[model samples]
Target: MVRREHEGSVLEAGQALRRGEVTSVELAERALAVADELGVYITRFPEHALASARRADREFAAGVDRGPLQGIPLGVKDLIAVAEAPTTAQSTVLDWGQGIDAAVTTRVKEAGGVIVGKTSTMEFGCGVPDRAKPFPIPRNPWDTERWAGGSSSGTASGIAAGMFFAGLGSDTAGSIRMPAAFCGVTGLMPTYGRVSGAGCVPLAHTLDRIGPLARTARDCAALLEVIAEVPFVAPEFTGDLTGLRVGVVREHHFPEDADPALAGVFDETLSLAEGLGATLIEVTLPYWKELTTAVLVTASCEALAHHRAELITRWPDFGVSARGIFAAGALVSGADYVQAQRVRQVVRQELARLFDDVDVIASPVASIGAPLLDDVADEAGQQNAEVFEKITTPYWNGVGNPVLAVPMGKTGDGLPLSLQLAGRLFDEATVLRAGDALQAAR
Candidate 1:
């Protein structure tokens, strides 16, 4: 029964705990065992997780509870600090030592959630997948050989494989959304400043955001209740999408580049939206190319500043991919960086204009479906790093809008296909509501 609960939402898990249908210790051990079996957690800290769960159980036993996440187990990104646990961030540069606790962890503890383990991550939250780090490459539970799509790779894979009900992941570009897409789960990048960033390792302070990835948007919403500064009104799960509007950009935005099955699923998703009374509208953003360029320049410069000391002191300790990318940041001129910021202002203004006409915009989470682990390895030393940047996330990060990646279905080979929906500024509730409707259709 506990194992069955693993595939359900964090809300369901909490219900089981409250009903005494499952013990925290039993659930913690089950999660830890699955983490080991699925290769979801690179660092299995069962002792820490069990102890935390036990504490939570005692609190509940005494009529002290912290809300929805009480006694729930979660895996946090290695980049986020866990007190007395090694914060490796999947970097060869990090020595094996305990790290001080981060603000997010502190909040979770206070909320009565158990930190099960530190999931794997790309060094310092860069998107490239290079095995130069000490930890094993995190595997996609849906298909072990495929890439899990980012710096939050392990967190997505871990949750999808039923290792944890939900987990914390950061987005500097699409770190959170991409992995959520590739892993067949739902993830959210809440409005900027909606959650605190204290204690988590910096990626690009301006662009980085921490959010939750879970099996469903409801689950993600439950986690958001903990991290968000203000109490969130969980969307009235009116699966009815009456009078809802969905905009699709097909040419350059969502092209034939998507895997066939993914394309099909997206089309099917459109039908579902229509059936629920949504009017699908076709739309395009102006100056899309500039949006992409501005994101790169801004993100690179911000990242360079954050890691200046580390890059200089322990340059060789970084994962090869991270080091290579950070080196490019150093080369960017002050003029180019400023120009990028100006471009960002333009992009944001344009996004604001678009949202005025539509409820939400939908697109593929990635141009291509999940790549094989071997493919990521094969391209490690490849030149034209900018090419990789263009092919992946950054634009949304630059614009600072809420992007929700909801698992639509799977590809021909069984890899997941996700549709990304970007909402107006600070409109996470509408995005989650849209996702909730889509998930129910599935």
Candidate 2:
């Protein structure tokens, strides 16, 4: 029965607590046990978790309760600091003995949420893992051999594996959504500045947004309200895509070399939308390639500026792959970075015009299902996977638009595939409303 609770949504788990069917301590224990079995947790906070849960139980008994998140167990991404807990960022660069709490941690604690532990993240928010670090690579829950996807790999894996109800994750260039796509969970990369990034380790200062990964879109919406401090209204949208125009960006829909199974999943996902009254239109945006190029150029320059001293002084402390990428930023010229930003402005202007013709843009969240860990071990396979992922994901990063990745279905091998829904800037509510309707139909 406790195992069943692990599979339930946040609402279901909270209900179980309210009804006296389970105590907070028992729930925390079960979450820890599951994490141990699945190898999901990086820093297990057994003592802190139990103390928080005990306080929650006492509050409930005293007729005082917080919000829906009151007693829910959560996984904190290692990128975000949580007072006293060692935040390794899955890199050996930091001395594990030191720790400090960030803004997000304080907010969650104030809301009565119990953070179970910190989950692993790739070194400094890049996708590749560093084995040189003390932490182990995060395995996908659906297929252990496959990559779980991204810098937020462990946070996504932990939530999908039912170690926690929902976990906090950061997205700069699809870090949150990519992992969520591979793990068969829902992830939202909220609008820029919608959620605070005050204490998060930066990958790209202008592009990063902190959001939640959960089993369903409704749960994500609830979490958005808490973190973003905005009221969520259920999108008044209903059945049939007949009048709702969805633009399938001809250039961004799928890569020229997308796997056959992934393409089929994408087509089926479109059909599902078409069946519900969505009209699919093929359109192309001007300078889409320039947008992505600009993002990489600017991000590389910014990252170099942030980590210059650390790279020079403690070079060996970093993982080889992570260091290689971050160090390349050292070569990016200031003139080129400014040129990229200029191109970025032009692209955003073009995207604004494109959106005037359609309500939403549809694309695959990833080019292929999760690949085997062994395939990514060597340099050739690593390069192939990196290029494949950037093809579908980085454009949204370039535009800084609000995008949501929802689990559409699974691949033949049982891994998950997802559809990306992008809305106009700062208009996440509309995208999520559409997601809620589509998720219900599924």
Candidate 3:
């Protein structure tokens, strides 16, 4: 069985600490021991993390409480800056000159969350691993030969492998959800701009978002409470879905080339949700093809605007895969980017009408499990077209809504299958509530 992050979750660890069953130092030590095992972290902060853990112990002993994430070991995706470490972004082009912590990183520290290290990600959170580069190419915990999905590669796999309680990840097009699905963990992609993006490196400025990845949706909720700088209230996971109108969207989630097991596993998950009193209504997304294309067009153009200078001066400094994407942005016409923006507005209105009938939309995060590392990329860092098609996460990013990906079942090969819950604009509370209940039912 795939051991999930929930086995050593934040809630449980907090409870253990309160009961004097474990110390923060012990937790920090345990987190450090395995940090290097899965090639998860790009940078490690041993002395600093240990000192924070000791302070946590002092605070706890003196009856002081920070928040839900207090004393919890957490990972930060390397694309986000940390004053104590370099923000490598898994590439060689950028220089970290006197790194300052990102806004989100500051919030996490304020909540007493221990920063174990900076985890690995796709180059600038955009492409497949470029093995020719000196950075570590993340390997899956489920099957080492298979890849840990990206561009939030190491964060999700590290959570699944229990390297740390949970971590922060960014999503432009399925970076968070795709990796969570492949690695058998829970990842939340909050509505764009829900969390501050002051210091994190951008992939597509128009499409980028930051969110949490953990073993369960409730854990994600707790993390969100801290990171989003929102009001605090732990989401209830009563496994009760009464009066929950779930929009069942199977339009393109189940593809012709999907794994044979996807249909069965997805059906079983829906049945379980229905059993919990969720009224399922069939629905289809509007302009799925147009929106998908829009995302590509918009992302490429925006990314090109950011990297055009460096790309011209030092093309070889970038990974082969990232180079191609940045260069493609140059080919996108101004009209194309504007048209994609127009499409975003129309989809937002259409989804509003759709949301009037359903509380949340449900679908498969992906149709297949993680592909082998050999298939992740070639010498030029090009991924297989068919492999990329399996991910169903980009649509939500384009629509700019809060979505959650949670493990529903396993494939025939024991790789995880995942379910997605998408909610109305800025309605992350409802999305997390539904995700927690569905995960609890499963």
For this target, which candidate reaches the highest lDDT against the unseen true structure? 3
Candidate 2, residues 121-226, lDDT tens digits: the string is: 7788874665556777878888787778786887888888888898889987788898899888889898777788867878889777788888877778767767
RMSD in order of candidates: 2.6, 2.7, 1.6
Compose the digit string of candidate 3's lDDT tens values, residues 24-66. 8998898888746667888888898999899998999999999
Flag regions of model 2 displaced more than 4 Å.
1-5, 35-39, 95-99, 229-243, 377-391
TM-score of 1: 0.93
Ten-residue region with minimum lDDT total, candidate 1: 382-391
List candidate 1 segments past 4 Å from native.
1-5, 35-39, 95-99, 377-392
Residue range 54-99, candidate 1, lDDT tens digits: 9888988998879988888888998888885877777766644475
What are the per-model numbers of colliding residue pairs? 0, 7, 0
Worst 10 residues of 3 by lDDT: 1-10
Q: Each prediction's Cα lDDT score? A: 0.79, 0.77, 0.86
